[model samples]
Target chain A: MYEAALTLYGEAGWAGFSLDAVARRARVGKAGLYSRWGSKERLIVDALAAWIPPRPSGGGPGPLREELIRLATAIFDSYFDPVGLVYLRAQLEAMIYPDLFGQALERLQRERIRLGRAIVLRAVERGELPEGTSPALVLDSVSGILSNHVLSTPASQRRALLGRRDEYVEQTVDFVLSAVGYRAQGRDGLLSL
Target chain B: MYEAALTLYGEAGWAGFSLDAVARRARVGKAGLYSRWGSKERLIVDALAAWIPPRPSGGGPGPLREELIRLATAIFDSYFDPVGLVYLRAQLEAMIYPDLFGQALERLQRERIRLGRAIVLRAVERGELPEGTSPALVLDSVSGILSNHVLSTPASQRRALLGRRDEYVEQTVDFVLSAVGYRAQGRDGLLSL
Candidate 1:
């Protein structure tokens, strides 16, 4: 039912998205939807939360750069997914219905920031990042670059870029680290400066 | 009339936007709109073209980094303006009405890329950038970062950031230059590496 709601929202956008349409698409009774989610706003918030992947556990067993690459790759995957389209629609809707859609978007951004802060803090603790590095700035730069790349590239050409996902991820990770003052060591060595 | 059409489009979105609404908003007869634009698609194309600022007359008289800061500032201003919000709406509308909106978007993007390519080519000629730097890549990175920052930041907080526009432009110019391997000489100095 949630999936159906998202699809309807994506296709119809805010102006056209309706409980009736969602019910029709999901092939469920209006009473069932009302009972489960209570309101469209509640349903949207819950559905978005469900779609968002939890932050990875343990940060894996890799160097800071490698771990960052993994985190970036995961973020890229989620943003390029169909659910991402729904989120984009929600972003547009926020312009019109800030109280409803804005709250949902704020929650999502906060969660992403929390997860990103944890990753950066772990790197700092491991002596990878500088002690006073701003987690918010780092996360924004990394996510902004990735999101911009995806949004600017037309859907038809995205497959070609995604085909070289590892190269893309590596370069982006390197770029972020470099921007934050991490200097690479000799070839194939971990970042030192 | 064009401004009226865009206003209606922004408010109603593509689904609800119509010749009638535009005519009503502009206080003009429907016959005049029909005769002038011939079709809704033609009207949209004309409106978008009118809204987009023409490329700068010249790259301006400054070092490559300074020129880029100016250009980035111009782009950021246009993007954060109300017309920019209308353009963003058109972008989302492109997904649903691809044939109509896609052609309009293609024209706009082509014009922007052409202008960006010209700026980068000039920098390369002056030995500021690498001989083989990809203009498209540079332009995308700069614009993407700016657009994403504006879009992600909520409206309430945008004023604080906009108040420091020069700093934002300077930092973004530095980041893009650095990402492409241009190193700054020193504090308040030209790029050397």
Candidate 2:
């Protein structure tokens, strides 16, 4: 049902999103949807929670560039998926419906933001980044680069983008690392530096 | 009429966009809208064209950092305006309706992208950047950075973001310049560099 909801929402803007439409797409009865979600907001919240990629499980901090590369790769790849529409839509809604959508998105993003912060913080601890480095700025740059690249690419060139995803991800990560003056430590892609 | 169209589209997304709604908003007759634009696509094209910022006129390129700061400031400011919603919606729609929306957006973006390219290209020619610096990457980084920063900012903290707008713009531009190994030339903000 959640997948069906996202797929429908992805194809149609908010205009086309309807309980009847979602139920039909999910091949379920209207009663079930009503009983499951009393309101469109509740249904959207639940569907987005379910559809969002799982946060990384507990793991010791890895090298900075590698972690960022992984993060950049994931963000870049997700934009090419159907979820991109949902992401973009949620971002738009957050602008207009700040009270409702803002709280929901903040709740969803809290943990994800923490992970990115922790990675940079760990790097700072390891002396890879200078003291007083802004984790928000660093993480935002990686994400922005990937998001803007995919969003700006012409439709005809998406396949070309996909083919160069790895290269692009590395370049983005490298750019941010250089901007922050990241120092090469024991292990990571930047070791040769 | 165009203002009404963009205002409606910005607030409501594609779902709420219609000739009837626009005519009502503009206090104009439906016949005028209908006669002016036979289809939503036509109306959307004209409305966006009217809404988009005009390309810079015939100024020879200024200092690289100064020019980028102006561009960054403009892009950043636009997101704070109502037009951000329209921009985000168009980006989302382009993903789903690539055949129709893609061509339209491509036509619109070509000139804007060209200007960013020219700025970087001129800098390179002036010996401010490396010979092989990728104009697409440099320009994309600036735009992506600004776009993501605004989109990620939460509602409660918007005023804080606003208070530091100039500072943030310089930080963002400086970060990109540092990453790309930009050389400071005469008459730019980077003279202090």
Candidate 3:
């Protein structure tokens, strides 16, 4: 039922999406929907939580190079999902409507920074990255690159962009990993010696 | 006179900035200002041209590495100038108020991308970067990283961020340069590898 609401929200944006529309899509009673998620904000928040990738695994004794790519790929893939895109757009809009959106946007960015820092920190500890690199800054740069790609508009351009997302992501990951002094196996394909 | 007006606009924001304030700061007659620039918007447009950095003198020679640093530093330095900050903020607001700001921003971004592409293209020709690296993607990532720095507010926080900006810019430059297959400069001091 919640996933149905997310689909409707993603299709129509916040203004066009309706509880009845969600209920109709879900084949569930309106009363049950409200009981499960009390409001639109609540529902959207839940949907975002549902959409975020679960904590990445394969940490123990894993190859630092491969694990970093796995981490980056999982992070990149999350943006490919429809619900993730919708939540992102909604958050961007909230930035402009600060009275209503500022707190939520702040929370989201802080959470992102925190999660990103952890990933960088772990990579450093595992000898996959340099010692003094600030996890926060790398997180900011990587997130900035990925978010820039995702937020580009004019739906027609998105297909070309989608085709190129892997290249951009791979290039960006290579950039960040290299900045932290990580030596990944496959970048030679892109880096050309 | 124009620079004073731009600085006022940046400090006060659009609603708060006034022609009288500009006149006061410039120590110029309002009549002279009105005769030249016409209005606030026109004044801002003119200031944008005047305040942009004069293109550097490296010409067709020198390492692409040093030229890229100069380019990024020019941008980072401008953020400290009051008028430059105002221009940056106004452009961001104008993104949502396109009818008011018109095509100036679109044109500006295109010009910036062109400049970036020129530098990257030069690198490829020099065999300093990979053949297939998309100049457009590289430029977009550059903008994203710089814009992320600009939009990060809470003046104190932004100040703290400045301390890290050099490191951040260095990493971003390294990222782009390496992603394009630039030969790794042994012991490139910033990355601490």
Please count the clashing residue pairs in each candidate, in the order shown.
Answer: 2, 0, 0
Candidate 3, pairs of clashing residues: none
Model 2, range B1-193, lDDT digits (tens) per residue?
A: 7888887777777766788988899999999889989877789888776666633334457678888888888778777666656665776677777776777677566766788889999999877888999888888888888888777777677779989999999999988988898988765534445
- When summed lDDT is taken over every stretch of 10 residues in candidate 1 chain A, the lowest stretch is A183-192
How many clashes (backbone atoms < 3 Å, residues ≥3 apart in a chain or on different chains) does model 3 have?
A: 0
In model 3 chain A, which range of ten residues has the least summed lDDT? Answer: A184-193
Best by DockQ: 2
lDDT tens readout by residue for model 1, B1-193: 9888887776556656678888998999999988888787788788877776533346665576877888878767755544445665666556555667776676666677677788788777666778888786677667767766665556456678889988987888787887776533434555555
Better candidate number, 1 or 3, judged by lDDT: 1
> How well does chain A score by TM in each candidate?
0.79, 0.88, 0.68
Per-residue lDDT of model 1, residues A118-143, tens digit only:
87877776667788877866766676
DockQ of 2: 0.58
Better of 1 and 3 by DockQ: 1
Q: How well is candidate 1 docked (DockQ)?
A: 0.34
Per-residue CA lDDT of model 3 for B1-193, tens digit only, reads 7678766765554544556778999898888888876786777666654555434445454367777666766666666665555545444334334444434444555566678778888767766667877776666566556655444432335557688877867777776666556752333423212
Q: What share of the true interface contacts does candidate 2 keep?
A: 0.52
- Off by more than 4 A, model 3: A1-112, A119-134, A146-193, B35-38, B49-51, B54-60, B146-168, B184-193
Q: Which candidate model has the greater TM-score, 2 or 3?
A: 2
